[model samples]
Target: MSKILLVEARLHLRDGASLLFTIALPLMLLVFLGRAAGPAFPALMVMLSVLTLSFTVLPTVLATYRHQGVLRRMSTTPVSPLRVLAVQLLINLVVAVVSTGLLMAFGPGLPRNLPGFLLVFVLGTAALMAMGLVIAALAPNGKAAPTIGSAVMFPLMFVSGMWVPREYLPEVVRVIGDYSVAGPFARALGDTWVGQAPHLPHLLVLAVGLVVSGALAVRVFRWE
Candidate 1:
């Protein structure tokens, strides 16, 4: 696992887009939003941004690997599909944690509760990764993954009050946002970063999402 992750990380850092999205874009978001939304909200945005990073980027990268026949090629060896997926996921999770820490150290932030924060972080990352893999499974080519990823990510980011606060969006969009990935995840981040209680319902929604998405992702994912 460690070896796989190290190799994947090296490959990831070499890709300009992936590296920027993984490291720069989120930090930029944290800086801009943190300034605009005030400390409390910007702090939360860090986690929110990290969640988006995990779901959107990891799948795209994996899809690229699939397109290049890396995944298909892997099947001829002893490595399990599960292990490959696990390594990529662990790498993404590490990126998320590191990004969150950077925000705490440098970016503006609200309060934080470590225990609840970690619970939300762990579950939220898993749910998003499941969804990401499902996207990767559904999209055949690496080139297509971004389209799929954006389709999944933008709405969640938009509606989740990342761009416009839920209070600002039209009621219809607001309602939709509530159910969107960003919506629930943002709410969960609020609880985590601010030392508030987890919204059990929102967290459950995340769990259900991971289950459904993970199950489907497994069914559809192909080595080739």
Candidate 2:
């Protein structure tokens, strides 16, 4: 497990240029936008919201393995497929922590509240991880990975309140975005990062989505 985790971690850090782009580019964007937006941006809140994708990396990577038959090869060995999945998840988590550390190096100063912020962070993480599994299950192949990733990510960025705060969006977009998985995710994460309430709707939608997605992943997943 440790070996697999180490290998996956290194791959993401080194070979996975796309992962770096997804992670670092956003941080840079947050920094620029946070500065540009001034008090308008809510830096910590938006920064925390990016973690949704970072956390999902493990699932996506695992999907790559499944789509490529790497998972199937691992299954023929003594190592259990479940263990491989566990290690991949652990690697992704490490990446998330490391990524968070890099962001906090210039965290743009957190808001006064701590507890409310933490709740949203935890909940947002859960939602993101669940979505990752859904993608892993649904994606057709390695070539499809990036497409699926972007499809999920783009909407989350726009609808979830990350791109434009809910208050700023037009009523129709806001109404739709408000209930969207990403919007609530952003709302919950935004609130928590700034030390606010759980934004229950966001967390609940995510929770429900995870449950549904997880079931689908199990149904469709192949070691190969």
Cα displacement (Å) at residue 179, model 2? 2.7
Worst 10 residues of 1 by lDDT: 38-47
| Best model number under lDDT | 1
lDDT of 1 at 64: 83
TM-score of 1: 0.90
TM-score of each: 0.90, 0.82
Q: Taking the tens digit of each residue's C-alpha lDDT, what string does model 1 give over 117-151? A: 77877777788888888888888787888788888
lDDT of 2 by residue, 121-205 (tens): 5555555666676677777766676577677677667755666666787788887776666677666655555556675676677
| C-alpha RMSD in Å of predicted model 2 compared with the true structure | 2.9
Question: Clashes in model 1: which pairs?
Answer: none
Clashes of 1: 0
